[model samples]
Target: MDPSRVVLFKSLSKTLSPALGIGWIVAPPRWTQQLHRADQVDAQPSALDQLAFAELLESGAYDRHLRSCRQRYRLRRDTLVQALAKQLPDAPVSGVAAGLHLILRLPTAVDTRAVVTAAAARSLRVADLATYHATDDHADHGLVLGYGNLADSAVIEAVRHLRDAVEECG
Candidate 1:
């Protein structure tokens, strides 16, 4: 990858709280200029929010919070994986190990939408993997399960609900 052509953007919304509405970007000089022009037409984050973020970073609080988040997510991810294995062995779960969410691939004959709907009825929110695709033709049958904000017991319980939903819908 050419660094000159690359732009990296990150937001505190994911790692920190969404309420912060803070983020940063690194881009080529030309891209930066264009982005600055665009920013003039768009609303920017509040000055207070930016100052709070700066203080958090300067005080080393951000790093400490990130370490805690990573540890929590790791435990949640492992718990979700184990629960899925025990509760829904037939469905294969796959994704990068470090993320807040994972994808559970259903059998080809299964209707992912129906499963999602059923899961919702049971108060367990799940996303159809196909919805993330740009086109229906490229979509696959699966569920996107996020465990980042859930407790260990909640993750297991969610997976159990998912298993029941699959059984009812599959």
Candidate 2:
């Protein structure tokens, strides 16, 4: 649900008479009645606005909007992967799906904190895997490359810088 839906629900409940909420497993007849009552009282947005909001929410608004974003991220991630593969082919890459970041595990001997500090020195933001887990020992040294907040050019450059940082440590 959108923020507006939440606000409208609150406003409607406050302004109108309070009623018991139907349980999740309500019968079809009672469910329809509840929906009808809600329609009478709910502060609904315009149909067109609602449609647009839904499109935006699902990331299926238009080809151009979705395509450009997908393409840009794909390229950025490719750049990061290529650089890492070239620099450290033995290091594994994981969790490169829908999320903003991809994980790259470094050599077991590498210091994860040192990688974080070096990336920071290069003006790159990254999360060391140790930050997410309790024990740093036996865990791989790596960085999570976040592509969502970064621009395409920035991502390419950042990945290049990352490659350099990793090479420097190695």
**Number of the top-ranking candidate, with lDDT as the measure:** 1
lDDT of 2: 0.66
Cα lDDT of model 2 by residue, 25-50, tens digit: 22345355666666664554556654
**Model 1 misplaced stretches (Cα beyond 4 Å):** 29-34
Question: What would the per-residue lDDT of candidate 1 be over residues 31-132, giving only the tens digit for each residue?
Answer: 877898777536677899899889999999999999998887887888888889999888889994747889999987888999999999999989999999
Candidates' lDDT values, in order?
A: 0.86, 0.66
The TM-score measured for candidate 2 stands at 0.59
How many clashes (backbone N, Cα, C below 3 Å) per candidate? 0, 0
Among all windows of ten consecutive residues in candidate 1, which has the lowest summed lDDT?
Answer: 36-45
Tell me each candidate's TM-score.
Answer: 0.85, 0.59
Ten contiguous residues with the weakest lDDT in model 2: 8-17
